[model samples]
Target: MKEIQQFFIRNFIAVPVSFGSWLYLLFGIGMNIFPATGLFIVLYLGSSFSIKQIQLSSNLKQLGMTRSEYKHIKNQLTSARFKVKQLNSFYGKVRSVQAFRQLHEINTISRKILGIVKTNPKKFYYVEKFFYAHLDSAVELTSKYSMLVNQPLKDKDLKITLQNTRETLVDVNKQLEQDLRNVLSSDLEKLQMEIDFVGVTMNRDKPVLEMKGDKYNDRK
Candidate 1:
């Protein structure tokens, strides 16, 4: 589904606009009224404009993203998702329960981070470094591990390789969790500060009444 959407965004306008231009050129040729060079120039310019418009519209449709924001973070977003997709592609090939579990965890964390980025693209800057540093390694290691475990022979070295990959994946999972925390750190701090301020204000604004009961008893 995602691949289809990406293909559409890339070609939806370019193909149709280019084809329409060709049709116009053919019609003009049939009528003997259009200059070939002029028609070619128009087609080139129109196709370029159509491509730009489609890209702009696709970027705008991204939640919490402006054109500038999308441009700034597009690579990071694309890279992260590409890594996730790479890991997902190995899902069916995962033979061991441990490998399957690790892949599932990786996919879940990757998707969670992707979801956060989608909703709060401004935080993409915070996460961009982490994704660049670790995402590729995680995907590669997971893929290698999946392939290793799926082999029919269980050699001593294969067992060691599997163990080492599993261990590395545990570290990768920790890094992913840390990345998520880093992305949310500012918001979490803001929420904590607000809660503290409200608590203090409520306590300070509470009225203290001690003499009212005594006054009623005295009047009686």
Candidate 2:
């Protein structure tokens, strides 16, 4: 229907009038009658206005809807991005201790990977060694930094780091699920569990929000 509308808009003058005007144009304008021309017009009009036209229009509307959905997703992405950055900054403030640094490095990498997952989830589905293959240095540095913060386990500092890590981990899981959906890889289930474990370790105190989204979208 849109195509037909567009065609009419583009070639408005080319659309023929009724049969009476055809006769007038034929005689008055000294035009030659072409049988094939009339046949083409009949075929084009019949097809353009048929049920198939409705289906095509519906499909185009769905495309528009999907584009809008993508925009909503972008908003979620922006929020996730800010959270990840906050986690990174928190990681950097930890004192320099080897064990704490190791833990920090892991946590940082996890957070960064979560960001990437949020931005381009298809990467998670395609890459075999996803975490290792796409390891960012910033992630590594942050992980090490986080670990360093945990060394002496000062009650106040440990409590704060735990809160930060928990928040970061929640964002990570949300991003991963968004980006890595419907993957055929066998490791997907295990990956989800591992992410959950990380979250549980970081926040033994807080309640985790169970996602209410559809497990499978009919149109995805």
Candidate 3:
């Protein structure tokens, strides 16, 4: 949808540039309609494509990554998004209100983690387990839990399995929370460093101001 919007904007901008020349060739120069139409189409398409490539390069530069690195990060994000979608799908299958809420919490955490890494593609490295194993575990366990919860028979053993699944999901939720912390750790560290630097700068200036105040008082 975003791409479509961009394409529309690009072509809208490209139209006047291409159309004026095409019109001159067709009407003013009395050129053949068929050839002029062909040239116009080619020019229009080429201009739009150039606009797209320029925008793509600009985006890659802003992200501080090469085209290949950007593509790799994008692919990883796409895969991670699919896993999150899978986790969300289980919510409807969940029978118990407790189970539904549990799945919602897990999905919420997954989304937060995904959103953070997405904006800073470099943070994708910080969440290997999240992209690979931990998320898969959540989806798989949820699948089993959802399936079993909807089963018609609730035997003694089945009840035990359900309880175990719920307990396991709690553990998975904790792991997801840990994953969120892991992704944010560097950001948190940077923030604290900034805060400390500001504090130290203020403290260092305080003594100078105090000495100046003392001199001013003596003169007074």
| Per-residue C-alpha lDDT of model 2 across residues 5-103, encoded as one tens digit per residue | 756643443344444456665776756678545744764466445545455456447554444454444554464455446545654466536434543
Q: How would you encode candidate 3's per-residue C-alpha lDDT over 5-99 as one tens digit per residue?
A: 77888988889878987999998999998999898999999998999998879767877889898788788789888988998788789988898
How does model 3 fare in lDDT?
0.87
lDDT, candidates in the order shown = 0.76, 0.51, 0.87
Per-residue error at 19 for model 1, in Å? 23
Model 1: worst 10 consecutive residues (lDDT sum): 28-37
For candidate 1, the per-residue lDDT at 18 reads 60
lDDT of 1 at 170: 89
TM-score of each: 0.64, 0.27, 0.78
Candidate 2 residues lying further than 4 Å off, grouped into runs, are 1-65, 96-220
| lDDT tens readout by residue for model 1, 1-220 | 4436765654675666666666676675563435644665576667767766666676578655677767667667887788788988998988778778878877887788788876667787777756787678788888888788778999999999889888998898888878888888998999999999999999999986677546636656
TM-score of 2: 0.27
User: Which residues of candidate 3, in runs, are more than 4 Å off?
Assistant: 1-13, 31-41, 207-220
